[model samples]
Target chain A: MKNALLSIEDTVALIASRAILFVSGPEHLLRSLPRGNWIGGTTSYFMTPEGGASREDRLFCTTFDDAVDARMAILPPNGLSGLIEHRFAHGFTCIVTPAFSTTLQRYAVDGPALPGLYNQPVFGWVAGVHLDRVGQDVPMVFDGATGAASADGLAALWVALPETAEVDLDIVNLFAPGDGESITFPEGGFDVTNCLIGGVPTNLAHYIVARGVDTTLPLVADYAGAMVNVSFQTVDAENGRVRFYAPVVPGTIYRLARTVADYGAAYAEGAREGSAADMLSCNCILNYRYAELEGRPTGGFVGPVTFGEFAYILLNQTLSRLSVRHALAA
Target chain B: MPDGGLLPSVDDQLWARLLTGELDPDIKTLATRLIITRLRIEVAKDSTVLPTAVQELRRFFVENKFAHRDLAAITGF
Candidate 1:
């Protein structure tokens, strides 16, 4: 499916024509669309074919033309466990949750522990507002089937592919656990005060300062060869507390990510080898900013530059991608 | 027989390691990850939450013909 950024009129025409879509745009522009078979979230930043872009007037639209059937729903606050149960027989699920909301946190902290989550491919991102209006304006996700928008609700779209089609969900993470002190948290949560630094209990905030850790580089944990990242949101040295964009699971070991001299080039190189056909991809907002990806091509993968990414689980500072391979193509 | 021509003994051993929490989730084979992760989650809630998960996971390995061939050497079993 060819994904592109389109005007409200164009997006509306596609919706009117019954295109099953996952859309990303500003709140005002998204609210203008007529109801149809689609789901959406608020985001003004995107990585379009022309490279990085931040446009409120246009919306990034991904049409799942290969999907045989699509269903959209507003998942209950604790409905993540049933994600696979509601999924199509042989397809994937796209989920959108508002950033910094309890809805996102619930999924982040409890998703991996929930049953039946790993049965299907799940891919999507956290809805976010423009950086200037983050605190002033709340991020919103739209249930295009009903044209209803809500900040606290989780929006899910389950797309059914043909029996002959196989879908793959993966991520391109440039960060690897650096060779430094191993860190472990006492409990799993976004906010942390105490952690074990190389088997020695220490305050995370003080450790970050004393060790000169770069907050931009996330803490990396290896999950079955998949490098998952939990990015730093703030280091409250005054309170001796540290906050992360994603939760650091209790049983996991985390280490500071090795520094990348050039984030854009590194990301581009990392994504260069992947096939771009029938691909749905999204990058993190932190990468867009830190890598200075605005107006620059991030290799072949392109879509919304979201607040957070999901590849079966919540992640930060990474590129999440999903692609469908039809039997004929294989 | 598993698809990759690996021995059933090696697969069973790997399965035992995963079920007993002797293997780290980070190093688990993808084919067994979900089942093992769910098993870990259930076992954490109650030690008795093992039998059902074990049956389900065994079925998964057979249905998928997963031998954990690539990981047999890495896991050193």
Candidate 2:
């Protein structure tokens, strides 16, 4: 695999070479690319070798050189399950859903119920606009097969791998459930007005304010042995409501994450365990902002700083990496 | 041992229990929900994921050690 930030001319040439690619760049640059075996999402922030930087002219591209066959598609509205049917039996799938779209919300809430979701290695991110232009600019994903861009469609690339190739996908999360109340919601959703705090009904927004809880820290839950996070988006104390980047599922016990004193050190420690080469990875935009990653290196981890990371399911405030390797012959 | 073969009878019992939310009381947990959902499709049809489903369930059952006698008899985990 080859991962790098390239000029529009170089990216165009790479696409013309018919290379299977996962591209991330500014919306205009992504829209300029020619049709080929590639899929793209809008994002200007990237973790480059030099350091984290937001560039509009260059595109971050990861080419899957070992993939023998590839198919790219844009899923229709409320059609996330279409990805399951499009999976390659022996390979992995990369998906890019536009941020704040109905498809993204649906996937956040209903993705766990999607059949065959765990049968294959599925990973990707929610495309996002620059932080400076949050509401003024919209996130978009591209189906490179048709040179088409959609603001709300879920774009996916399904690649068929050779027998010798193996793909593994996982996440690097720095947060763990803090020693606090066992929080649970009555229903699963992105917005919440009421929740059970240690089995006592409490207003979520009021609880956050009353306890002086740091909104930057996400609510963490143990999914099997994995620590999943639902990052806080906004707190409307007057209305007794709160919003989260990912949905909080019903019956899932949660606690606010333990504080990390140093973000750079934690990520660096996590990066040391990752296989930097031959890996297609992405970090959360929240991490980029909270850690002040601009011009700072995350050890060897590099890719787009996405709005949200996908490892089987949508994740928040985490790093998702997918590595493809070729097995040695006996 | 083929990838797409019909799941063995023992696994079918586990799959049935999973469908009925008997595999784990906390069925709403992300992992349990995913495991059950996957089995729902792979069990209903012969697919390459059946073997994977069986292995994952065995691993989960072994780790959690669900106290269901029927599950223990079916999986021996």
Candidate 3:
């Protein structure tokens, strides 16, 4: 079975036919389908059979067979991780979370506790806007748990994992931090109006000017061996304040990494080594844009062009994939 | 970092489709292509993504008699 971006008629037939489905595409497009076996999120880009790039209101869906037992859940942001852990604690074959942007985009660290925190392989994308801000482009989620739909909520689809299934979760990242200067924040978090430098909280914009650090380079934080990225939004030298893509978390230690990522190089290496057989991927927006991947191919990747990626952890500038294979019956 | 090797998956034309029958507002798509100024992340493994496994998926939905009832339909309240 393959994951093809369907034509309009085919998409309708697939939805009407009733098949186990997980959908990702432009929010406006997915919203049109009858909510039956399908649950959708929004995105315009995908790595389909046509290589690594396409932007349209097309669906990137995966249909499952009869042997798999599937269940859905609608998790409020309040206790999402716990809900997932509770359901999939015994483990699942596949876990998909096509959630609203509010749940996925608001936090840089992606909240203190997230479902991806679990060791299991999680696959998903952030539902996006493609219509009127009031109705059409509104980000949404369809809770398989309740068989309902809404905005600013989480929809999780869990498939029954085989007793002896060999599940492999993989994330393809292109950059790593180099030995660079250690940058720590103050006891009190620095606001957009200022920054903390050398134990003294000062004007953030001024600090960047004085240091001459490339404001474009994201501030990387090494936490418990995981690399968490903090991207800058605006650095107003006149106002002497700097902003970030997401708010800088409190008490989080950061380091300014001297990173020179080669997307061409990384993509090449991944193409040579990576596999897309029975895999679903959610690629990072950063990777697509930064790597200048438009019209370029990442070999065999096919999934959503997402704002962020989850590989048992919220990851930026990386491609996350989930692979499930049955163990040979012994 | 995931260590598994990534292989190719054939594109399934079944699950996701382009619904032309439905109408959509004339809204502009989100232009977030410029967000990334530089690209970098810790790469330690080969990303292994599997092809779509639709045989069993299609079978599951077919036998289960798949039908979605909205909140109103389910509750009848």
Candidate 4:
């Protein structure tokens, strides 16, 4: 089976029992398991059918039928971005870790680029929950060795599937245009380091104040015909900068739209297009808390509630998922 | 200076010494800072008990010696 949301018992049982395995859940429980055929990050949220919104410390797992050989690597903070494209240049990869993680903190600003992963279906999430890991668990990707999640490290799980299996990456965005106003950075980029708009490199907080844009609402852009978006993280009034969970691509034109849509319909259709066969999926914490998805499901997609997501880039306020299906007829 | 075990009470000694009758502006400021630092330490220990801490401060004020009027105007003293 490509994917299944196994119970706590079944997950622990299935780990070493399977030929190849990858898992996600809380740090303490994941660390408790014996070292075997699995790797996971710390998180308690998942997407299930009752509109899939819940903090379940259970595992969403993947098990390949045939004995699969995998190459694993630890991408340190400095080199993670460059390393991904090179390592998984040809194979399928499953990356898991928490956000503001030292390994990921650089990318929070660097706008990490993987040389040739545009077509490679690289999927993962920035995993962690409200700082129970503060004094206890270290928010991290662990492999059972008294690991520290924050300061210590992060992990990338790479698995090469069978020839028949092809990967498809999907994003479930539930926002339609509301109060549309086309926006852009006319001259340069707006990042944590230099927030600019209309060619003036000022802090994002300044620009937002100057423009009176609601920082809570996301900005969407038309990449060809597809509407891609960037979500806000913190409005650093002190720093005069606004940090986003994802990067605002340097030269793209964006529009400040009041997002208005239904989550249930968005995830259901997106997941179905991938044949409703997701091995890994994560909804953003923004969508979870702000969208009030605590007990409700998002149609039929389910996984962890992540701090951020990577559908080849850092994403916010979106559910990004992956599946391995047979190549559709050409 | 104390010969016995009774160290002079910080509150009692301070009020007895200066800034009493019509409270000078400078000494009042120093007194305000002294009370604030001690209150801040207790609050910082755990902010969850903030309301209870405030009540405790009010109780201490009620039990203590002569001082400024308008306890309602006092934000945290």
For model 2, give the TM-score of chain B. 0.39
Error of 4 at B40 (Å): 55
| Candidate 2 chain A, poorest ten consecutive residues by summed lDDT | A269-278
Docking class of 3: incorrect
lDDT per residue for candidate 4 within A154-246, as digits (tens), equals 566676665556655657776644554445543333355453444455565776777787766787754423445678766776667666666
CA lDDT, candidate 1, residue B53: 60
Give per-residue lDDT, candidate 1, residue B4: 31
Which ranges in model 4 have alpha carbons more than 4 Å from their true place?
Answer: A53-57, A65-67, A81-90, A108-112, A131-137, A144-152, A176-181, A185-213, A274-279, A327-330, B1-77
For model 3, what is the error of residue A174's alpha carbon versus the real structure, in angstroms, after optimal superposition? 2.0
- Assign candidate 1 its CAPRI class: acceptable
Q: Which ranges of candidate 1 are over 4 A from the true structure?
A: A260-274, B1-11, B18-77
Best by TM-score: 1
- Looking at model 1 chain A, report the run of 10 residues with the lowest lDDT sum: A269-278
Per-candidate DockQ vs. reference:
0.29, 0.11, 0.02, 0.01
Task: Single out the weakest 10-residue window by summed lDDT for candidate 2 chain B.
Answer: B63-72
Please provide the root mean square deviation of candidate 2 (C-alpha atoms, Å): 6.3
- Give a tens-digit lDDT track for model 1, residues B10-74: 33655556666776644434425544655665565566756666666655554442224435543
Best by DockQ: 1
lDDT of 1 at A203: 97
